[model samples]
Target: MTAEQKGARLANLWDKTLAAGMSEPERLIYRSNLLGSDKRITNYGGGNTSAKVMEKDPLSGQAVEVMWVKGSGGDVGTIKRDGFATLYMGKLNALKSIYRGVEFEDEMVDYLPHCTFNLNPRAASIDTPLHAYVPKKHVDHMHPDAIIAIAASKNSKELTQEIFGGEIGWLPWKRPGYELGLWLEKFCLENPGARGVVLESHGLFTWGDTAEESYLTTIEIINAAIGWFEKKITGPVFGGDKYRPLPADERRKVAGALMPVIRGMISAAEAKVGHFDDSDAVLEFVSSNTLEPLAALGTSCPDHFLRTKIRPLVVDFDPTNPDVAGTIAGLDKAVADYREGYKAYYERCRHDISPAMRDPNAVVYLVPGVGMITFAKDKATARISGEFYVNAINVMRGSSSVSTYMGLPEQEAFDIEYWLLEEAKLQRMPKPKSLAGKVALITGGAGGIGRATAERFLREGACVVLADIDAGALEAASADFSKRYGSDQVRSALINVTSEEAVADGFANSATEFGGLDILVSNAGLASSASITETTLALWDKNIDILAKGYFLVSREAFRIFETQKIGGNIVFVASKNGLAASPNAAAYCTGKAAEIHLARCLALEGAEKGIRVNTVNPDAVLRGSKIWTGEWKEQRAAAYKMSTDDLEEHYRSRSMLKLSVFPEDIAEGIYFFASEQSAKSTGNILNVDAGNAQAFTR
Candidate 1:
């Protein structure tokens, strides 16, 4: 059978499955499995689906209804009945009445007491109310690649209009959950017959009276948009002549140098929000492009601004000059220009409504030949923004064939970029307020440790700057965080910690970017294990440079500046390991960690006089799914120990006195305490959050 026939058969099967009079629980199970099975429909935990089930309450004579929405932390495709949070529809509607125009996080917290659930379940979807507001009995949302591919295009509005016509109502991107629900509620009331709501820079939301109807409508709408986009943006095959390969060594060097900056930028975006998207296509596109202007195209979607800023750093590398200082200076000037232009756009767009602050939430990096690096906090966000740029580039290139694809006017783009309502939604999130006025810089922020630490700082109210060495990962991570936190509270930078000049420049840039730094988490480091006999000088130097010297350089520069000028007693938390105090089989790895701990101790003594507190958190075998314990290293350790991977993991956990695997989040909490006023009298202290493994002092 043809592909179309196969799809039709699947659709028919889905319809029959739901029509079998399955209970709500069984229906949800089938629906989730169907959605999860298709990557083209949803990614790992990417999309959400919900069904409004009406049931009679035991106590009351009147019938009670609850929205069985998808719970947090579960993949839509594999979600079960328990994954749905059963919320009283009346309570949610009542919340709308009491908190009309009020902040969302506040509403969520205020209504938490009224929600009758296991309470231990992850928080409800940010799009809960939006789903509840849909008049249909079932609702579905997805980051379908084909749909978003069209949405990311510059002419998405036009394309959407052509395909969906009056059936779709478009809503500009807003932080999801309550605000999105409110906007969706208002739109539904206004456009009575609207089949679906298309969130610009976000994803599609469709609903229907039946489960199959909702699912089918979603697929149909997305397919329509994809068809329209493909027909309009066709291109001929250009292979051999178009492909250019760089020398392997040069490519590696360029990739290494570019990684941290891109990662940092991405991490910063996520620190504010809570999530980002890291699609495979995004990573391939950014890494493959080796041109100047083409690389400068900003994020694939607006949500990416939450990860990688709006644009990338434009690098003009001149082989003849090879002046690092000159190249950096030029980049700085370009950023300044972009910021000024952004401000001008905001000013022009401002009306009687509240205006956005002067700071540009995102940055565009222009790296000549190596393409552009779009950095954010989390992979998801960076991916979305990167996808937006990919689509924009397609439009720009495709438009050259047709009429030029006209982008939103500068003022219009600025209006949405700096929308006060969107900003307000972020300000109202439910998070701790300890780091409110402080600025923090987190390195290696896209990884598990970096992401957790950044989240901790953001929770305590710190305006965080997350930096990392993996540009793609950083952008994806930063985007995720920025969506949860306000964009203003977080910014990402791309910087290499090993380079003294780069470190200094990054710090200075951060100081200017966030006003001044108050908390510095020098959390970026690496671990490489080699038996003493097999250790090479090159490997030793690389490990020491990244883990030991890198910490020294970042702390030295940040401490002096914070002491000399700011006079604001800053907090510096270096992520060390139990390996610093205990002997590990890997000599170079242990030495580098030991050196980092000593450096922290010395900095603590020196910074104490300036009222700055420097401390370190020693975490051992934290097993938080980081790169250190993945791939070859994990396999090697398991083999050497003569145990299965699961056994090895269990052994590590059992070694901890508390019998709990040390989590990056646990270490992040320790960092938070040291950075916040809670540890006001604490300085130069080494806190071991290794679950008592350190007390035993065993390797």
Candidate 2:
């Protein structure tokens, strides 16, 4: 087919995608075809697409529905309905109302629990609210090759002005998802009739009342930019016309040396599912240019920075030099310099946030004589690196003729790739604890503390079973966690901690789901407050029956079955509180907390014989926004503490030596330490995260 015919066919497919009143699965299939049809539109999983579906609300007798957004790490070209996280629209809208006029990211994390979608296999898109805010039936966002070429141009604004005229709106590059979504939200509210949005230093977002308009707008915008570049510039003619393929023996050697590093970055499962593309596109780009000029070009877009660092390693080896040691040392120095630069960038952006993993040689770009090889732990990551370098080369070539290309500034690029919003996207998914290949059961997994602990364990790389009595909350939390983490990493079971049979069944379910349990977080509990005189038997019985008895039952099962049977060392953490030792107005709560602490101590002593380490985290007020501190609870706590709601929060923070509020994340860190190798020699400990709230002399 002719080029124009191919473009038209892709456009027609997009039209069909929007026009057809198909089910969610069918729409995903069509969307994938349209995006895949044009190499310029999307490569592999570079973009995201979503559709809103109507379903009955189990809570209210209403026909409320959700938008099934594409999950993380899933390719848009092949994503299915199961891959789309079902974010309840009503819940999202409600959250927006509660946190009215606040930033969308804050709203998302706060209201994440209300959404009824499972968290595994699917996750709400990082751009979930952006798609939701468009007021369109369907939304399409992509990193189109043609658009990136134009955006990466020296005269990008001028080029866009000439091609799109006044139809396109340009947004200065901000971190995507939350900040970008907010900016787009305001821009859309103002313009109301914009054709599409061109995110400078990022990508394009196009939408319409119908999916076809959104898709066509994306196509037209890209075509216009491509046409302008073609008209304005001419391609360079190379003198070397002879095409020579590398020798078969040498090619095999090159591939063999690189395969191990590549395989480590991604999964064997993903490698089998998708075709690896370490082809001429990547090799040609690496060998075409001088190392220095190529490094100066930056990434294709800021998003690509996560997969492929800002640039690659310039492998200039002199095999004939005879001093092999000197050559290897020189290469090592180059890599060390790259790592130093990365560290400087991190330090500059640091604000009490923990540091991310640093990969010194994300990509290795060899010279003309030497073959190129990209390094990633897996094929998926390696392919991402390969694709990014290929795109960057194209941009560099296109811009060199016209003018120097300026990419995202260092800070802006850092923010895009490492922003909390993006990190939250990865965290939303469930995984095994740091104790990978081990089994864990998190009680009260539906609650704030329990959920935080569960997410932390999953990230550390362990399979988790989240058990809770609140079935609705459990389902919603599980759905949200699974979307980013994957369904296999976590499972949800409904169990009332007060019932022995239910607790037993929950453990059985966990063992069946994850092979066997090795860690137990006895996190299930209540938090009702009442004066000693006001506290009744009912409240006392309720708190003790669950918090105290629940801890004993869960720990007992782990010691007998999981730890002893596997003959592996195990860990048990009780989510006790600072209030357990300190005085509190809530009589029942204080009694339960104190008993829970004693139970942890007893269990720790008993489990020592079975090679299980039991511990507890005495957390101070974890005041981050969530349902626990919503509305009256927040206001009342603030009032009783003799400060404005906001100021009252500062008091809790001031009590800590770090002057930072004790976040659920801080408690999770403590949990991780106990479960990690660093704490292997230690056991029967109580980690206090109250920020020095309890002085020894005070009691």
Candidate 3:
């Protein structure tokens, strides 16, 4: 296309965005979408966009100018109008003059609400003032990797001017707040021709009288910086890839071996209790040879400083090192050193900020051969932090092409890390679900009850491993769950829970996959319905081995992992209501379930002091979608009961006091309670999810 034709087409597209009769907020949404839709421009919650629009004040009956800025915590990529907060521009700007004498915390936080024209629940982005201070009708702020590559480099200021000349303004690193906003406002006024300002070690900001102008200016400037960056490079960016990675299998083995050791140490120090996060991406990045220096130099930008911290804690990974005393002692010491180093870093600058020392634990842990692992209070944050680091690595590698990559000075990083407004973003967040950040293992996980339980735990934000003897079914279930709740959070393993070796290997491998295990749902079992006159020794043994012994084997392995980590875990057994009220022609099944229930009680008593909680969920008839209630087993049971399969199902459902059929999902809820903190003070408890089976209820 001709340049003039292309410009006309671009103008038409821009006009389409404003579509006739659209409200100002709608236009803002349209423009924000343009900025957020590109992950290359902004990731998850890494950027904010705003528009200055006039709206009628319901109480005052007068038109008022308001700043509609992106709110805290939601991803801009999918944000709605409600995702943006409205603050009176005049009021917000007025605070800048008087904000000088106020306590930095109060000035930064306490007065924010009074300036809100529509004081809604959502908090405005920390960059609200930066957007408001600009006299333009629209503003765009983003952490585009290309711009960050330039802004985070050692000679960012000089290079920035070199690339854009006087068209861009430069603001050295300042934590986002009223002060930085005021500084930006003054800079823009002084350099009215500048298209945007690059906040050093932060991100890019562009503005114009219209959304189209601001958005295009952001794209145009970043593109220019990237073009300049490409021209500067004369050689390989990653120091020529001198490092060779271990084979994928070997990498997994190494990661599996070292993750728990790292997790245990960090969990104890940072969380005080719970498992740390480990992922395949982290493994790949840490295993890369470039990780050490790139990470040591610190986060690529300041926005990331709050998420990934200044530097990742690097752990030495020697595959030849045996997994005995020396290895354990060395890893423990490495973690201790990382913690102490962080404390020293904090001590050097804590007096500059008012907030107490944030958790001194490393958010990112880099291991030489194995890979990197990141930790957070919850799985989402862990995953997000890991992603940011991965982006940082790529940006830093790219930055090396032009010049050596360097992050903000330690003091600047420290300021952003403990900045009260940044910390308050976390404080204002709603509480997470009970099982968030937890790891759960479900045996017979391909089966109905097991799959339901796995789904429940995953929905509550737990990393789940589905362990089943049926390899085909296990693969299918794993694929479905992984698709639903991220492959990073779901895993599947094949194991005969009745075999000690298989159980041990399964639990060990799962613990390696997720850093550690927090909850075990022993739901694997076999069902047999035979009278004493016809029951065979094999039938009785099969039921007992799987139902009773399977629970024992799996729970024992789980306890070993939990005990090693000392994180206090949970074990939930899916027992049958038959254990409570035995039915005719089910001797083997009843005996096995009865034994399992009692075993759970015994484990509850034994594991209490160790912080392990054991509980049982007794489910009656769960015929729908159950693998156990099919084929020859179904035929045999129907014949024994002298009723057709349909009749038997109806009979069970109607017999319940609630006259409703029980399902795997119903049993799953009861099991979830025991697995979550909801039952923190309860143990040895038996919950009957049999649709009001009074006979199965236990006090």
Candidate 4:
């Protein structure tokens, strides 16, 4: 097909060259990855695919039919060979004898371990039976938007027939389990010629004799649905526009202004990361007259609402008037109402066996004329939740245009949301780290001390924004962090801390990126070793400008954000031991450091009522990886001590009472202690990380 033709349809990415040298299981992985590479076919971790392969049993040493399927909690797009669980087909089939009806179907999950082939440790997902019972050699199950659009319509069954005719069948909504497996098997038996079936309000399943055939069939079926929708949608979707979106820049400003407050309000229980989406679909939906009604009805696909929740809370705002302040003022009541309603929903739908009520905060929030906001425990999840909602928007657009859209039934949704098995999965998850869900911004982030601190925070589960005056270094550092941790857990901002406008803009960017700040590490600094007599006015201004004024500017911006959030914040100052103890010949440096230390004390005194904490970590010397040890400062300090630059580290180490060298990681540890809950109640305190420097003691 031509490129234009492919653009209008799902591209068949199957390559015979790529598939020629692969094992059956390997081909399944390849096909699954191809199918999942596009969000149009499947959302992140939302779909499963399988193939039946004959492999020698580890114990019996005999070839047996083994079902290889995407393991539980695995995403098909990134699935490796090990991601597929291997189950013996004979054992899976034998499970039908003990099938005690739909009510007891959940118990069927327990027996899956017995069906494990070759003692594969990967757990079989609940969808295993759905794939296992299908007699086809390969099956592809997906939550494609175009397919689900038909599946979620009020006339879904008829629409399915209209779209695919006899090529694909339709099955009414049945909670996926062993029972649903039987339904699929029955459908396949009844319509042996049919290639696929669309599960009502769930997704699509297609099968073929080979992995490539199944993958191609899945995409082709979705492409057909896409073509049908394109031809059928006659007018504007969502009843046309009610309000045009704010200008892009204005929208960002609004998001930057609003997210922190919302994040702070909802983050009382646990810290959250925020994701903002103003995509074309989101804008179209939010600006529509039907936005409120459509959003209230909730998303149709189960995968969509699993992350987005059943429905979104539409923010009260009129784009025509653009009253951001007014909106902020009214947000408290709106948020409170949303929580109460969510609680009532939990109370109304929860079964006695249901897990306890979870956080009542809405995951997805819609702003008319701006876009969508989603908050979650981490940035990736929040971002994915927004993406899922966008898929739901597309689903609603298609379903509503061709026919009436229908959300999943309340009881069915509740059952799935609070399913005991789902609860067990939640319980089985590892405990969150101490800094989990926290957002931090570190100035001088490209420098050794700053990068070390950020690495520590990222390791402990905090999302970090790396801000620096050096653009190249910032980019390099950001890239390194993204490689080590993940892009979702870190962002970078080019910031001249001494510039008020730059600092303000950087903080705003940080707020918009991660949904507000929780920890601010004011580590940006430089050093000079000039005597009081030799320190020129230019040198004095330079030191004071960056060290003193820069700190003030960043702190003011952080404080402004902290006030907006109403959540307690943390500020860790990477000051110098010279701040407390006199340093010979380093008059300007000592004064600047002294200013940073005093500023922390004053900020602590002023912010204690609001739960903000300010603390200082004083280091005598951190030469390794320290940017301050470069250029003239190192030579100046060395010459002042009557030594060469190479001997400065040794001289400082020997001069310390503990006779130990201090590295950037040591300063990072001190900063971590103050920034974390380890010092939750202590503020205006100084930590001496100078290897037993008696002169810099807090006393």
**Model 1, span 408-445: residue lDDT tens:** 44444555556564566567666646666567888887
Better of 2 and 3 by TM-score: 3
- Residue-by-residue lDDT tens digits, candidate 2, 419-438: 67667766766653345555
Alpha-carbon deviation at 479 in model 3, angstroms? 8.6
TM-score of each: 0.50, 0.53, 0.84, 0.98
Compared to the true structure, candidate 2 yields what TM-score?
A: 0.53
Flag the better candidate by lDDT, 2 or 3.
3
Predicted structure with the largest TM-score when compared to the true one: 4
Two-way TM-score contest, 1 vs 3, winner: 3
**Model 2 regions more than 4 Å off:** 1-11, 14-21, 36-39, 59-61, 98-107, 117-121, 237-280, 288-291, 317-329, 369-371, 400-403, 421-699
lDDT of each: 0.62, 0.62, 0.77, 0.90
The true-versus-predicted C-alpha distance at residue 300 of model 2, in Å, is: 4.8
Report RMSD (Å) for each prediction in the order shown: 12.0, 20.3, 5.4, 1.8
Number of clashes recorded per candidate: 84, 29, 1, 0
Among all windows of 10 consecutive residues in model 4, the one with the lowest summed lDDT is: 1-10
